[model samples]
Target: MTPLGRRLLILFTAVLLLAGLGTGVVLHAAARADRADQPQSGGPAVSTGKLTLGQKGRLAFVNGAAGPHRTAVASVPSTDPRGGRTASDLKCARFYAATGTGVCLQSVTGVLKQSNRALLLDRNLRTLRTFPLAGTPSRARVSPSGRFVAWTVFVSGESYSSAFFSTRTSILDTRTMRLTPSLESFSVVLDGKPYHASDINFWGVTFAKDDDTFYATLNTANRTYLIRGSLSRHTVTTLIQNVECPSLSPDGTRVAFKKRVLSGATLWHEYVLDLTTLHETALAERHSVDDQAAWLDDHTVAYALPANGKVGSSDLWSVPADGKGAPRLLIAGASSPAPS
Candidate 1:
């Protein structure tokens, strides 16, 4: 063969190879996009619609189902949690609503770092205000009267399962627009004495009917404590040890919290603490739950557990607050239960 013919053949072969590689890349990208748009098999049906915190007898949460509505603030009838879900346009990583107010934590990718923020929403699900967050959002709650909102974020490590991590918790009064940037500034009373430490961290705040009273998990010296706090006094007092993510009951007489089952392990079991007697009752849920539980009513508490055979998703379950009944599935492919 002549030299000119050989050179032309080589050039043609290279062009064909590059074209094939480019086509493959495009196909792979398209396939990923399609998967994200499609719903997971056996996932609950969700439709886009208007959702409101003031809707009577409704339960709201962050939709974890894989579909177009994934991560959107979704709601189901409190009486029919297994029924179809109505998703709103607002998306959040964590959310909670009470009375007529909602708090939504969201993250946005930026050029240099991920930007996190919290949106205060009205009864109509409209954004009333936005507050910048210092890190990745983990937990959120609103007071029963809908006057106060609180959120927790991990400033260092992302997971509670990690051996070392730092958190920043903030509370805001919607009526006056007063903000408490971090709970660490509150005076601490540990074991009936004033305490101070650089390692103190607070998270998973749950408020009582009285706006001034709240409960949260306080961690320091490799131990966790349930602390009762007062907004007016700017003070916190340790109540019990080994308690995390306390959720006050609707009646404000009890708190549902996750108790660490194994030392130095991430396993935890749900328990109900009677505020009057300081008695703790182990709940019927045997599975290790790692969520801040929410009260469905005065007698029931709902929380999230990892969905079976699904990654990055969870299912909401409820059991009797008295520790007598078994856990019942409240909602599939959902997290952050906020019942009203």
Candidate 2:
């Protein structure tokens, strides 16, 4: 072979090798991101099982790691608690404002297929009653008046996710002690017409002041919808698109939700939808929020932001609902923030 040909062959081989190494780096980074998006399993349990109060203007949320088993509910003081006693086996909890009542959902086993239960709790996070349920727990909420409670669980073979993780959302009327097994039974209307799809799944329920009306997210036909539902009619009507995890504001005038925007890298931006005018104002939060936001007051919204993309590393953050202020960190190593 000519000397020039031999040199060109060596140069071409080197180029190929460099290209292969670059591809490998990209693939490795992609794998790491996927793993980070998954929920973390088996962390060290909470050492202190104490349940604090929001009465001192503090926030109450699922301690997530506060019991003997580590999957428990906990509270953070707006100020230090004067005296308190801890509770064990919390699993999960959500408190309503000023009602001294909340709902706690717990899975007996960490397995997704195992049975779960919802417990009615008093102000101090002590269980008053328990109801058995199916599926792995996900979200829990209580009405503003504490007259109603709702919970969502992931059910296999029913969800429309590419991973097949569907949801079974249920509601309980504490006043009548009536539990609706699933929201799937409710009728849905889309585009001014009746829409029925077996793949329909609902989650992220936030109730209104009257306790008779609520807002939730419904995923169907490979799209997400913000739905306005009524407890009296047992039906849901689609209001807008690309919205999920609806959280009603404290004043009942607005709803804070995640708006899915697909441009370059699909992003979920926090947006507040004015109920009266049906308008949306995107907040200043730039990170992807996979949580149903909690209202801190009439003007502020708090939610869990997963740190480094890992679900277990969620941190609590607050932002102005009107899309004016910058995001501020409220608590570290905490999630599912519920203000008192």
Candidate 3:
């Protein structure tokens, strides 16, 4: 199909799903009903014991084995392990835990092009409320104070290449229950000049300690730029180039992101950029990491790597933020690691 035709097809699919006109819902409901007897994997839904609230060294991640239809939010002691615990009630594609609260993007009905929901829950994994979302769920994160929530979804676009996809990122204010439809709605300035481009797209938002300031990847003119933005002002200004999926450190002094390195144009090497000095430090993880890393603490960064080079199975690994220590396994069969 032509690129225009491909885009139209994708748009039509989204329109049908959003308009509540897809049969996928009925199929999904039946599948869920059938699996009611068999619980989703990752462990039992037992009490987490003194770990109800996020701990400084504990980590919360999504279990990879738990299929897209129903997944579990698993938790384990970061530096120490008492045992394993899973929140069976929390069936989400992506999740982020912070400050005794969490935000999750869950597929409510279907497997692939299904209707999705954004859930806000307390430390115990109890849902406070949910917002219906559009597009395929990708990533979800909460601010340091758990006051702001942000998410990204992949949507169909006008690209003839089969790999072409567009991203839709949204933010929600938990205090007021206000939602921004898309980050694309905000104005962006490049190189101190007011800039507007039709092809502008954004993803992978990492918030600062202030909760109002954030850094995200902005794609325009066929180049990726790291743009710093403010929720209060709704404006993004370019900070640097070629950085994707920036993860701000706990102290807000540095950002870890994926930088392309190989000639194949697909390999992404992880690197940390010091926000104050603008100096970049290459991490020790030699393998191509395609995840937005989470800070295990002020000194460590944790991310997911495919198990045995297989995409279906992923294991969480941690490396020193200062590039001093070797990567070590933190958790097995996990993706989307969020350190508390």
79-186 in candidate 3: lDDT tens per residue?
Answer: 553245544456577889789888888776655656878888888878888888777677777888988989987776522122466888999888998999899989
Candidate 3 wrongly placed segments (more than 4 Å)? 1-51, 55-57, 65-70, 81-83, 108-113, 157-163, 309-311
Q: Cα RMSD for candidate 1? A: 1.7
User: Could you tell which candidate, 1 or 2, scores higher by lDDT?
Assistant: 1
Ranking by lDDT: 1, 3, 2
lDDT of 1 by residue, 52-159 (tens): 786888888999989999999999988788889999999999999988899999998989989999999999889989999999999999998999999999999988
- Model 1 C-alpha lDDT versus the unseen true structure: 0.93
Q: Which stretches of candidate 1 lie over 4 Å from their true place?
A: 1-3, 6-10
- Name the top TM-score candidate: 1
- Encode model 2's per-residue lDDT on 1-340: one tens digit a residue: 8999999999999999999999999999988877654434553223455554346566665544322333345565544321232324565633333377777776665556555788888777777789886776677888878888898877765333334668989998887888898999999999889999888999989999888999999988778899999999999999988888899888888999987777333467899999888899999899887778988889988888775554555667889888997998776556666677
Query: In candidate 3, which residue pairs clash?
Result: none
